[model samples]
Target: MGTPTDEDDGVAVALRDAVRTLTLDSPHNRNALSSRLVTRLYEELDRAEADPGTRAVLLTHTGNTFCAGADLSEASARDAPTDAPLGLAGLLRTLVAFPKPVVARVTGHVRAGGTGLLAACDISVAGPGATFAFTEARIGVAPAVISMPVLPRTDPRAVARYYLTGERFDAREAARIGLVTCAADDPDEALAPVLDGLRRGSPQGLAASKQLVTREVLAAFDRDTDTLAELSARLFASDEAREGMTAFLERREPEWAVRQTPAR
Candidate 1:
């Protein structure tokens, strides 16, 4: 396990036996996937892959929200480029194609691209009350880049329902829809059994097994990633997207949302 870098570095690595747990430490932003965080995550995962002692990788976080999705503040900045989505697409590819089993431990909420990261993991365990939603449509964009990994794992019916509604679903629904491995009152307890099982797999055996399981997912990435990324970037740069992001930052309802009577 490597010593944690400074808080500004955005990710921390802790090794427990053969498992390397990477914590998204940027709680100030609800562990939002900033460019620096994404790059450092890729680097750490790559390092774990190269290390002989590391057999599995765990993606966890340090806040109430597991991840709030892309950094909207960064995206809404007029000076910002569409590079964030491109980088996120690359990170999803890394997680999907990783030779080792990547597990995600979720204790809170996840939204938009965060769901993509969760879907790319080989296994994901969430607390019973943790919530998830695909929020791109609310923000005047589609979940294009994330669809690369998401579409294959999620039930088509569930995808159609949630993608269109942007409704928050609990962990149980996530598990039912094949988006999560399980939901437990105690997520760490739930993960213990999984990790105990994985620890017994041999290095070569695990590598080959991961390859076998991910073959279809890898093919999907290869077949459609560039097209999806382009779609993501185009939507991010659209006028409606700009208004949506601005409305979010200003804590106001977006123009597309109907004004409702304030509840007593």
Candidate 2:
């Protein structure tokens, strides 16, 4: 087995036999999505997909909070940036298109972009305390990127409601909505049994199954790429998003009016 840290510097990739493990390691920011992190993750994912020895990939994170979503700090630091690659969207697309299985082992609050990360995986196993939220609306952003893959995991109506509302949901609720495959008291233990099952399948069979499932889900939706682009543009430009981000940085409640807006 070999583990390599890609150039982007936020993700660590380890390969063992047919399994690859990718860990989000920006604990200082609770594994928040920074441009650097996103770029690195994409690179590593590409590597895993191309590697003939890899059949499955496990996505995990450090700290109690799995992923706090996009690093607002990073966004705030940027000035007049145009045409930056949309990280979350690209990652989700890669996962959905991946021929091999991708598993998520979630163990904390997965908010905003974090929730999207979970939704992108082929299967998700969350710890008992894991909570999820589509929080973009609160910050004046849309869950446009993550929504692409998330739609397949849960009821459309529920996704619409929750995503629009920006409310937090526990693991049980996630499973109920089909966003999670199962919840576990011990994530590592829970994953062992699932990995064992995956190990029984031939790599080619697993890859083919993954491809079929992805195609089936994609066939159901008529994605409006233009609409998503517009929404994301508006989200980044909205006053509510600015206010929500300010509040989060200050560790306080955003003004009530801002809170009412759905961020996801």
- Among these predicted structures, which one has the highest TM-score? 1
TM-score of 2: 0.87
**Can you write out model 1's per-residue Cα lDDT over 1-264, one digit (the tens) per residue?**
356532348788887868889998888888888887888898898888998888899999887888888899888888887677778888998998888889999988999989999999999999975899999999899989888888888899999999999999999999999888898999988888888788899988988988888888888889988788888888988999999989888888899998779999
Model 2 RMSD in Å is 4.3
TM-score of 1: 0.94
**Worst 10-residue stretch by lDDT in candidate 2?**
76-85
The alpha-carbon root-mean-square deviation between model 1 and the true structure, to one decimal in Å, is 2.2
Report, for every candidate in turn, its global Cα lDDT versus the true structure: 0.88, 0.77
* lDDT of candidate 1 at residue 3, scale 0 to 100: 60
Candidate 2 local lDDT, 77-174, one digit each (tens): 43724333254566667777787789999988899878777877888999888998898877767787666667766888888888888888888888
Model 2: clashing residue pairs? 136-263, 136-264, 137-262, 137-263, 137-264, 138-263, 139-241, 143-264
lDDT of predicted model 2:
0.77
Lowest lDDT 10-residue stretch of candidate 1: 1-10
